[model samples]
Target: MAFDNFYYCVLYEKKYSDYFLYQCILLWMCRKTKSSVTEQQPDSSAIHTISTLPDTNQYLYDFLKMVLADQKLQYSYGLSQEVKNCLYVESDEVYLSRFIITPPQTNPYDQNPSGVDSTKLIYNTDSSVSVNISAQLILNTLTLLPNHACLKKSDITYMMAEKSRLHNLKWNNQKTGFSLTNKNNWYTFSLPYFSKDKKKAFICIQSLCPGLCGSGDVLLYQFKNNKWTSQKVDSWLH
Candidate 1:
């Protein structure tokens, strides 16, 4: 006698022997249902397994490496070498990582340096989400073009006059000076002294005109393959 459904069980329940068989079948069905439910349920440990944040210093180091590897900026700045001995990590907030780049000491015996470079990390609080890393050149007196003999006032004036002509603008003859000033004048200088290799040079112009036209610009000229090729970098001044 086969009991496939509840109706079958009821129909078969007649004699004592049949009643005993139906009772056994009900017990088996109950056990099978319990087993199936248990199999479908997820394990609590597996579901609640916790993830953690990466080591801060290591993460920032990796980030800096990637930034230095950028083809365009690396060719001009050589950030990889500059940052090798100077990278540091700290927390600005619970969710933000700060990478600080300290300048190399001027003197071997000096224990402290005055300049500091910093970049902030922006990321989601959720561990499962991706993180965004970014950095920028922090301009300062140390980062600016250093004084060079080639950056004479007369040379600056000629360069500015040529640049003005190309742009269909007038060169501010009165504003030509070595030091940066607030007046709407032209300040031209060369930073050949800053290049460790001595084969690259930077020329900067600061113009404070009456309107938005007044701004600072830099040009990087690298002596490569027996010729000088010029590249424009982002302005150090706003």
Candidate 2:
């Protein structure tokens, strides 16, 4: 309910009906008060002194972090609850920023990307994903790409996706090899070991990518003679 309140606040803001909003908040507060009293055993004064007035969204989230610092919060964890609610509000705001209001776009390729020496996890011997992370030079954007010509025959870096569901990898870890395949009709990175018959690994170039443009292909370097043969393998990527 608290999270719902945050979402409503961010998305509708001035549009929300005052009565409806107040009711929702009042209901949420009642639920929280009951839960805190039973679980935390706080004195009656703690409950009575607490205020339900709306506050700055960021403050709500920060307050949550402080409450969570301690292991216990069964009674009055308003600060912690508010922080979680803040995150939810932020996510909603981002989604709205992208979908409902599409602003003028920036050319992601124009910016300087992560370091050339930086290496990222492309696959982890698993089948769920294959990605390259960059960030030798931090940009305002989460990800970036280099130019197409650079992508044609160069290496690039991209900041890995932030911590998330459906995402796995030790964040900012050095380059770990990866593979991608359609397993059970689902695209997956990381191939099983000892499956010599399967595509083993996936690689990418992040030179000109503005974050992760998904340009270029996997690294398919094979040595036939004294010379090395490097091929672009994006299609071969998942």
User: Which candidate has the highest TM-score of all?
Assistant: 1
- Residue 59 accuracy (lDDT) in model 1: 28
- lDDT string for model 2 (92-138, tens) is 22411221213446544434444333234445556444344443334
Candidate 1 C-alpha error for residue 176, in Å: 44
Candidate 2 TM-score versus the reference: 0.16
How many clashing pairs in candidate 1? 1
Give the per-residue lDDT of model 1 (tens digit) for 112-177: 353332323446555343333222233335636433223333333444343333343222222221
The local distance difference test score of each candidate is 0.39, 0.32
RMSD value for candidate 1: 29.6
Backbone clashes, candidate 2? 37
lDDT of 2: 0.32
User: Clashing residue pairs in candidate 1, if any?
Assistant: 184-208
